[model samples]
Target chain A: MTMRSVGDGKAEFYELLPGREHVTVIEPRANPFRLDLRELWNYRDLVLLLVRRDFVAQYKQTILGPAWHIIQPLLTTLMFTIVFGKIARLPTDGLPPFLFYMAGTVIWTYFANVFTATTGTFAHNAHIFGKVYFPRLVMPLATLVSRLIAFAIQFAVFLGILAYFAVTDAAVQPNLWVLLTPVLLMMMAAIGLGGGLIVAAFTTRYRDLVVLVSFGVQLLMFATPIIYPLSSLPARWQFWASLNPIAPVVEAFRYAYLGQGTLSVGMLLLSALVVVLILSAGVVLFNTAERTFVDTV
Target chain B: MPRPVIRIENLSKYYRLGAIGSHTLREDVNRWAARLRGRPDPMPRTGAAEPETREGGGIWALKNLDLEVGAGEILGIIGPNGAGKSTLLKVLSRITAPTEGRVTMRGRVGSLLEVGTGFHPELTGRENIYLNGAILGMKTREVDRKLEAIVAFAETSQVLDTPVKRYSSGMTLRLAFAVAAHLEPEILIFDEVLAVGDRAFQDKCLDKIQDLARSGRTVLFVTHNMGPALDLCSRGIVLAAGQCAYDGTMNDAVRHYQGCAVGGRRQTR
Candidate 1:
């Protein structure tokens, strides 16, 4: 039908027919945590494109390219080895000191990178977010995926060092628990994503949280069993350490690959519960914040 | 009668005056407490009140807006600055939520609120096409199909592989516009993007918008250039002081806008 005049002298109007799909109604979100899985699935390609953009844009104009990914973690591990393992005389629970720190650093770097990137989702992306409309979660989700690519590269460097120690040193041995590496990585991602989303949501209105997050993450690293094994702590302290969701994942990762740290099903379950709670809460808050964050951010 | 592609009912958007929102947690809590105590909000009103009546406080960017667009209607939105044109588009595109009321759309909406919206300077033009296309909700395959047309329309074939940072402002705008033009959504919203580029490119954009309308896709266009608005749109809406001042045929709306611009009395519908 084309535009035409009606008998009433007003423009002819039309009513929607029933059963035609593709209707989109814009209203206030009824449920804050209601995830539009279909929308996210439809935007999967955008997610991949953003992942590519993040990965490429990060190293553009850099001298070393993706080598910087490996170099960053390697350098950090070196400093930790010198300060914590060498000078401070920290014990690695009989495992090789270099390998011990390497394992922790690689996993922690992945978590920290993902957490930091996701935390900046609103502030860092205010430009794009202001001018366009995409599922806001895509930005943070893409950050997580892109950081995983960097993590993969760094993990390979860690594996190379682990391999060197496995061959050259008699004390270094990886058990079947090494197979739980994927699970450990997933936990790290969940915790980072959840924690970052919570912080990102808060930073939308209260920007002071952004500064807090930057330093808070660094301080949090010390509290986790990253530089020290959980076994080295007293029994009472170990129980408290396990309460930190990241502690078990880090401990399990080391216990899996290096076979040095303590691993308990009960602690793993508790960590999983914390992950679920944080992630659900974060998603709810993030979804709510994203709706109106452009105005505030 | 054709069905309306879009319907907006009593939409209102209230924005705080100076700051974005609550500046601190303490302030937010105080505001929340005020709401609980059933007291008036402490924020000042800060939007265009009435055509010549100036008041300062928290402004309602859009207030009690009710509108509808029939499928295939190329509706032009003409308004002065601070008239809520962009705010209406933002609400229609779902970029921002309305403080009151609701909007319903019968199809997917593609908005080009600004050119080069998500274009990264470091990315090559070709890469940005895919990235911008995806950001506009186009599938990769869709972008693939339109890649040749987009490059030709933009006339950036030579610099397709070069980073966007090196491109001139005109070239970047053309490329960004080309990608947006090819999005092929059922409903399209554009806000002053044609203000860029040379005259020839502006003509091409108007022609493209006309083509999109002829193909039965609805379009909500916001622009200050009344010539194009009258030339391209069958229907026009004039927004004044965050409210719809005139809604009629393009000719009448242009007259109403001209009258308003010239300090004549507003003719409200």
Candidate 2:
């Protein structure tokens, strides 16, 4: 029998060998803790392609197309201004109600989008996951990046509003803390992604969590001060309210954009600590779930 | 001696029967209590069983299977439905985990467990090409390099930009197969999806698979059809009741499967 070598450095032969053993043994990993960074790095192009697929496929047949991205937030802000500002006569901390609610709506919208998309990672992509093998983390990670792209488009609308208010009226002022805008956005994303991954992990077997997610997010909005200012909370409840991870992010965003709301370095640091804890826990749970979610999902 | 590119040693996958959340918390607590006392499981009948016969509470999709695929070999895997064929492919592709045992694979694996796995009907044929290619682990540059050949092979260049939902099912299958075959990973797995296409396309796929094996790529093919198994593979394995019943030359394995199908004694090699 003649022996030939393959490109992967293994030898091939015409005759079957009786005693040869397999070089790679695949067993259930005792601990699915090791993240395959190299494999993920190799599949980075796929992540980019998936992001493009999501962004493009979302607006493919719609008449409004990408306009819906702007329209959704614009309409929501208008609704909030009428209900919370005009009807309820809520305080906007000396900032115009439209811009305040707009700022809060834009940031909250981004977090909500990322949370829902990432949380549905396994359920939505089960078909793809069942067929192929790549870094499973790519899907959730791609959702984060693509939603960030969507947020960028919406952020452009916010910038247009900011510029309009800056030149025409003195009601809204851009402070130096505007430099912290990117940091605040990153924290929102981390918290949403971290929370979404935990939920996605649980949803494989207990599908009740899937139904609870949308309902829970709506309830969470009431808890976060999106329609109202954090300063309006009674003095006793202020400390406990800041404990909500999203509370500090919305507060910081409003403070940066309008120079009106509270922006404390201490609270921001505390929010960052909460994000780190949730994100690490999310990563661990998500990694373990990805290995076997295909079967259960 | 040449080393085996794929090795499966005593691999097994156990699955719970029926719905995933069928048990109540009370039943779970009782089961745990029974186990704590070093006694037999309270509901042994509902416990895990081998996937082939489905006798117990749960089923073992695969049970203590030992297999090895040599480098550049085309190994045909054949069995009846629920014979652990799909389960084995899922385990090999790492889509699911094995409950017991281990499998080691030396190179990158490309699996076509189902055709058009990530294809979105709303996307155009051209766009689905890129998306599906990426899902199959091809980089943008790689897909770009193979774009012309893939489009040409599928014969869908005229309607390339049209949404795939408008295309006939055959067109979709052709495009999916063309992309999958052209990616050229080190190991390729196909799971009975070839039957979707016409006879001519099926023959074309078989020809491509033969060409792939000839070009020094390992292939694990699961199929009910024996013609391709005998024609393309040098070796084959027949799985029955979640275990390998026969493993030898392609012709012998096919004969063994035929015998079993006709209620004859299962001949082992």
* TM-score of each model, in listed order: 0.91, 0.90
Cα lDDT tens digits for candidate 1, A225-269: 888888899989999989999999988888777767888878998
> Where does candidate 2 clash, by residue pair?
A24-B104, A25-B103, A25-B104, A26-B102, A26-B103, A26-B104, B46-B57, B47-B57, B47-B58, B49-B58
Where does the lowest 10-residue lDDT sum fall in candidate 1 chain B? B44-53
| B-chain TM-score for every candidate | 0.85, 0.86
Collision pairs in model 1: B44-B57, B44-B58, B45-B57, B45-B58, B46-B57, B46-B58, B46-B59, B47-B59
Write candidate 1's Cα lDDT for B1-269 as tens digits.
35777878888887766655537776767778888999966652234243243335467888899998888999999988999999999888778877788777766789999899889999999999999999999989999999999999999999999999999999999999999999988899998888878999989988998999999999998988766546889899999878999999888998989888877444332
Model 2's interface RMSD? 5.5
For each candidate, the alpha-carbon lDDT, in order, equals 0.85, 0.84
Place model 1 in a CAPRI quality band. Answer: medium
Could you report the Cα RMSD, in angstroms, for every candidate shown? 5.6, 5.6
Model 1 is docked with a DockQ of: 0.50
Please report the candidate that would top DockQ against the real structure. Answer: 1
